[model samples]
Target: MKKTLIIAIVGILTFSCSKKEAEKNTEKTDSTNTVDSINTARTKINDSIKALNSKNRFRDFSGSHQFVYQNDSSPKYSGSINFTKIDGERDNYTLSGNIKSGKNSVTLKGFAQVVSAKHINFTGEITQSIVDNDNGKPYTRKGTKTFMSKDDGKTYRLQDMVNGSGFVDYIDIHF
Candidate 1:
């Protein structure tokens, strides 16, 4: 009876030790995964910024367009916009500056984070009231632009424009 009890206790100890090691390994794996996710997000943000700063898009550009919100319920307001870069800045740099779309002028603030040379993410914020094209009155709403890019510093398209519109006009993104 004594020998049997001793053997049972040894077996339990061995099993418990093995279980603890397994749990530790799982924890290590989870930690590694979390780190990788964070790095990926940072890389995406950085790449987005670089793409918006491309000179090909902003090297003295002008265009007129209309925008509709969700549906055609809004009136179509037409407008022209111009874009130019600040003096002495790199071709592919962070974009946070002024823009003139139609009769309204506003400043743009942008955020970009990079995890590596390839992964990037970019976001832009516009906070100010501008004159409404339909009524010629001040319109108030915060605007944010977002996009993603894989290229080192090339073309970038619109990801999203959030919160704000007047007279159904397409946004002008120049410089």
Candidate 2:
């Protein structure tokens, strides 16, 4: 009877110790997975910044793009914008293009300064023509725009815009 009690106590101790060890191991694994996920996200962002910095910001920017206005209810404007001139040393460029959607058209001429791999500041004048029914009127506006990339520089978003009136937000840009 004494031997059996001793054996039972030993068995319980062994089982308890093994269970505690298993829990510890699971905690370690969970912690490691969290760290790994964080590292992966960091790597992706870093890769995007590197890719953006390596390319000619001016050349790559010459393409057809779609701009969705934050405050407008109309569909997005699609057009071709080109950087006609660039100063590589100063990271400045001039762009001119026209974009249209429905009866609204915009002619834009602008200069952009590359602030970093992920950001660009633009100052431009836009001649916007809107046709209400059969009548059309053109208006000119000057503004400053800030472009920022969030997803590893795969695309850029127009985060802020300052015109004569005030600041505009939530304008999305796709390249």
On lDDT, the candidate that comes out on top is: 2
Instruction: Rate residue 164 of model 1 by lDDT.
Output: 51
Candidate 1 per-residue lDDT, tens place, 1-175, comes to 9999999999999999999999999999999999999999999998887765543432332222122122134333322222224433332234454445565554445543332343324445544334543343444333444433345424232344433552333333322
TM-score of each: 0.33, 0.47
lDDT string, candidate 2, 1-175, tens digits: 9999999999999999999999999999999999999999999999887766555644356444655443333355556566543533346768676777777776767987767778877799766554531244665667887779887556666664432233342344466
Candidate 1: regions farther than 4 A off:
55-175
Q: Give the distance in Å from residue 62's predicted Cα in candidate 2 to where it truly belongs.
A: 4.7
Residue 17 local lDDT, model 1 = 100
Model 1, TM vs. native: 0.33
- Go through the candidates in order and give each one's C-alpha lDDT: 0.46, 0.65
What does candidate 2 score on TM? Answer: 0.47
